[model samples]
Target: MTNMALSGHTFPSATLTCPNCQTTITYYDVSGSSYYGCPNCHAFFKYENEGPPEILTTFQPSTATPVLPIGSEGYLNGQFVRVVGLLHKKEAGSFYRWLEYMLLRQDGRYSQLAEYNGHWMVIEPTDHTYSHYHVGGKTYTINTDEGQYWLYNQYKPELLNAVGEFDWNCLEDEKLTISEYIRPPSMLISEQGATDSKWYKARYISRSELATAFGIAKDVLPAPSGVGAIEPADPDDRSGTLLAFTGMLLVAVFVLQVILSIVKPSTQLLKESYQTESDSSGTIKPIITSSFDVDGPTVLAFNLSASLDNQWIELPVTLINEQSGRVYEFSKTLEYYYGVEGGESWSEGSRDDDAVLSRIPSGRYHVNIYPARDLGKPVSFSIGITQNTMLGSNIALLLLLFSIYPISLFVNKQWHESQRWSNSDYSKVYTEEDKS
Candidate 1:
C-alpha cells in the first residue's frame, strides 16, 4: 500500500487530502491527536477523533458501606445482568489483583468470571423486580458486557467518586455507563441511591464478599505432546524479577565453590564390625563373635545350596545402639549408595567406601546389625559400619565448613529450572532446564 501526498506534508499532522471534499484535511496517526484541515471551508469540519468518549453522569450516587446482600435488594439485573470483576492495575505493569461477582438469571448459575485484563462491565437494569427484557418475544439482549471473556474497560476512579480503592458494593446501588473501554481514568461509579450528572455521581467501596463462582480444577492428565500453560493474559514484571534471580545465582556460585573446596573426611578413618557369609544351604548370618571392626571396602552377599544337612536359620542381624539402649531393627538388610566408576556397584569400593551419618551430637552412639530385607528369611550377609560411615558429626562438620557449595549448586539448579518453567511448558521441563 503506497500513496503519494498531494501537499508538502508539513504542519504537525502528516496531512492527507480527502478525495470526496478535495479539501486538505489533516490526517492523524492511528493514535488520535493533532489534526489537519483547510480552516477556511464553511464546511470546516473537525478531525474524525473517534476515541473513548467522555463519560457523564448526572444522578445522585449512593455510598453504602457494607455491600448489600445479593438477596437483600437490587442484585439481579433484569434477569440478564452481568457481574463485572476488576483486576485494577495497582501500578502499570506491576501485579494485578482479582475480583469476582455473581450474575443472576440469564447470566447462568454461579458462573465464575475474572478481570478481563483490569476491566469489566455491569448492566444497569431498568426494573428491580422483573429484571428481564426480550426482543421479538424470543431473543434476549443482555444489558451488560462484563460477563464475557477477553473484554476490558478503563475509567477514572475519581470520576466515579471512589477514594483510596473502591469496589461496586452492589449493582442495584450503582448504575454506570461506559461509552468506550480505553485509556483514561474515566468514571468508576458506586451508585448508592438516585443519581444524575453534575449534582450527583456514583460512589465506590471495597466490600469483603465471595462470589459463588464455579471453576474446574487444573487438568493433570498426561499430555499427548508438548504443551504450555496459557501465557498470562496480562503483562509481567521482569525488571525487578530478573534482578532477584541474579542475586540468587551469585549466592549459589559462591557456595558451590566452597563445597568443592571442603575436605571430605579421609575415607581412611573407618572400622567395620563384621562380615557377611552364606552356607551351602542358602542360610546366612553375621560372622561376628560379639562385635568386630574391619576396613570398609566391603561387598559380596551370596548363598549356595550344595552340601546342606540340618536346617536351622537365625533371625537377620539388626542395627542397635547400646549407648541409648535402643535396638534399631532392620527388616532384612539396609542398602547403601555412593557415586562410582561404571564397573563399580552401589557398594562401589571394596568394603571401605564410608561416608555415613552416625555422629551428630556429643554422644557415644554404637552400631548394630539386623536384616532389612526378606522378612522371614534369616539375614546371612556380613555388613560393615565403619567408624565414620555416615557419621552425623562428620556430615555436620562438612555442611558447616561449606554449606554454600552443594546448597548453592542445588538452589541454582532449582532456580534456573523455575525460570525455565515460567517460560516453558510444564510437562516438557526437567532439572536441566535451568542450566543457564
Candidate 2:
C-alpha cells in the first residue's frame, strides 16, 4: 500500500525498500534528485534515474525529537507544506548547532526552516547572487569568497543526524561552505562550492509564531540565549523613548518658566534710603513704606545695601497685606569683613543682602523695616523691593528633578550598547591593557 499526504497541490508518489533493513518507505520526488533515509533503521540510500536503491551507510538516530515532527502539515507563504526531512548540523571547532527542517509543498516546491538556540529563521532559495540583495528597502552587498577567509572553521559543518526524505545526496562527512551577512533580525546566506552555488534569504521568526504554526505548545520550546545574528532589537527598549519624553518635559518646564516670567513681570515697587542713629535705642523705629497693589500671587524681593567695614547689619522687615491683615516677615543680614591672611588681604562677605518672600496674594501691601546696629554708631542703608521676582532656587530644584529621566536613559542605552559589542573583536573593555 502507498501512503501519501495531501496539501493544496498533489504530487506523484513512489515507494522503495531499504536493502540493508528491508524497511518499506514512501516519498515524493519533489526536486527530481533521488536521495532518502530510512525512517525505521536510519540507513542512508541513493537512487539513480532508473535503478535500485543503493545503501550508503547507516547513521545514528538523533535522540531528540523535533518540535515539528515528520508528516506534520502547515500552510506557509500562501502554500500548503509538509515537514519531510530534518538535518542537524553543527559548526566545526564550536558548540554551535542548528536544525534545518526541509519542507515540501504538494506542488514540488521546497523551503527550509533553520533553528539555532531557540531562534528560528525561514530561508528560501533565490536566483539572485549574493553580491547584492535588497531587504527592508536597503541594499546589502555580500562577498562569499572574501568573507570565508576571516571566518574560522565555518565551512566544516558536521551533519549530526537526519531523517525523512531529501532532494540532494545527503552525506554526513561532506563539509558545507557557507557565507552570511546580517542586517539585524534578517540575514543573507550564500552556499557555494565547486559543484553548486546557491543564495538564500533568511528571516527571523519568534518562537511563539513558530509554535503556533507547528501546532505545539509554547512551553515546549527552549528559551533563547545570547544575541542572534538576525535577532531584532527589543521593541520595548524605552531608552530612546524615555529620553525623548524627558526632553519634551524639560522644554515644557522651560516654556512654563518663560511664560510665568512674562505674565508676572517683576517691577520695582519701592526704593527708599533710611538711617539708623546710634543715640537711639538698639531698636530703631519701623520705617513705613508706600503701599502697592498686587494683582496675583507674587514674589516680593528685598535688597539692602549698607556701608560696613568688618561689621554686620541685621534688618528684619515685615510685609502687611492691609486688606486681609496677613503679615509676611523676612530678614536680611549684610556683612563685609576684610583681614590679612598670609600677607594677603581678602574680603569675605558683601555689603549687600537679598531676601525673597514667595506666593504673596493679591492685595495692598506695606513694608515695615526695623533696623539694629551692633556698634554704637549710625549706619545708612538703602532698601528696594521688586514684585514677581523669579526664584533661582526653585528653578534649579525643578531642573534637577527633570534631569533624572534623561540620565537614567543614557545609562541604560550605554549598558545595551556594551552588551551588543561584547562579542566584537575591538570591544571597549579589552582583555589586555595597553602599555604604550
Candidate 3:
C-alpha cells in the first residue's frame, strides 16, 4: 500500500526510487548534483560512475545508476536534501526515557523537538527524509541529512541501529572500531574501473571514524574562534543558576505585593457624621451631614415619613461631585421611599445606605426630603465617600500576578526565539537556521 503518512506538494514516489529495492530516494535538487544508495541490498552508493545529475526528472535509475549503486535522488521540502540529523541525551530514569531532541538543518541551524518521556520509543523524522529505522525493536527516524550524519557519526548506533556494538541482551559486551570490521570500497569503482570521466570520492563513514581518519578527537577539535566568551563546560551549573534566579525573582515579587497591600492607607470611620435638623410645626424634616474628600459621588439620607398620612411628599436628589459625571436610576429608588413613613429610619440601617452608593465611585452628593403631608418643604442632606475599597488591593494583586507567569512567558519566548547559535563547522547539509 502507498504510505498515507507521506505528505508534501511534491510527492516522493513521484520523485525517484531504487529499482533494486524500490525504496524512495531523496536528493538535493540542483543542476549537476547527485547521491548514492540501494534499499534492497542495504548498500550505500556513490556518484563515481555518473557525472553530477543535470536535472531532477531526467536522472533515472538506468542513466544515473552505477554499479556503485546510487539509484535515485528526489527533492524534499523545496530544497535539495537527502539526509537528516538530531542530538540526544542518554538519560537515567525510571525505565529509561529520551526526553529531548535537538535537530540540525541544512544550514547548520538547530531546532529542538517536542519533549518526550519514554523507553525504547522510536520516533520517525519529520520533513524531507523517511528515515525511520529500527533500534531495540522501536523505529527511529532522522528528518534531515544533517540529522542523519550527526546520528550515524557522532552517536551512530543509538539512532537507527538495533545492534550497537552488541545485541539488546548483551549490551555490556565489548565492540571493535567500525573501520576495523567493515570493508572500504564502492561498487562504482569496480575491479575494472568505469570509463566515465568523473568519479566521486567515498567519504561515507561515521563521524567518529572520520575523526579517527583525520586524526582529530572531539576534544582536540578546536572551538570556533571569536564566537563569544567560552565558558568552562559544566552543564549542571548553568541550569542551577537559572532556576535559582527565577525562584528568587518570584519570592521578591510576592514580598513586594505584601508590602504594598499593607502600606495602602486605611480609611477612617465617617467623621462629622449624623447631625440633623427638624422643621417646626406638626410635620418633621431632618437634614443630615457628613464630610469626605473622595473623587466621586456620595449620598446621605434622613427619615421623613412612614405612613401615607406622613409620607415623603418629595425629595431633592443631586449628584454634586462636579469633577465626576453620572446618570442614575433614581426613579426606581424614589418609588421605594415615597409614601412610606417613619417605621424604619429612611437611613435606618447601614446596609441600606451602603447599597445605594456601593457601585458609585468616590464623590460628594446631596438629597432633600419632605414629608408626603408637606409636599412643599423637602430638606437637603449632604453625603460624601469615605474611601475606595476596591482600587488599591486589586491593583497590587494585578501587579503581583503580572510579575510572575504570563509576563515571564512573553519575555522568555522572545529571548529564546531571538537567540541564534552558529554551527557552520558542524554541518553542511543543514544550511538553514534552525527556526524550530
CA lDDT, every model vs. true structure? 0.29, 0.71, 0.29
Q: What value of lDDT does candidate 3 attain over all alpha carbons?
A: 0.29
For each candidate in turn, give its C-alpha RMSD to the true structure in angstroms. Answer: 22.3, 6.8, 20.7
Please give, for residues 1-436, the per-residue lDDT of candidate 2 as tens digits: 2344543343555566777787877666534647777778888888766577788878887665678876677667676777878888777776778888888875677888888777788888877774543221222344454341111112467776767788787683354677666654566776767677777777788787777777778888777877655666553556667767878887888898899879877788888888875435555666788888876677878888998878888888899999889998988888888999999989998889888888888888888888876875667789898888778888788878977766776775556556544543222222334222
> How do all models score by TM-score?
0.25, 0.66, 0.24
Model 1 worst lDDT window (10 residues): 199-208
Per-residue CA lDDT of model 1 for 62-113, tens digit only, reads 2322121221112322333332211111212323222333332343322222
Evaluated against the true structure, the overall lDDT of model 2 is 0.71
Which is the leading candidate under TM-score? 2
Preferred candidate (lDDT higher): 2 or 3: 2
Q: Is candidate 1 or candidate 2 better by lDDT?
A: 2
Candidate 2 weakest ten by summed lDDT: 145-154
User: Where is the poorest 10-residue window by lDDT in model 3?
Assistant: 178-187
Candidate 3: which stretches are off by over 4 Å?
A: 1-40, 43-384, 387-393, 396-436
Candidate 2 residue 366 Cα shift, in angstroms, is 5.1
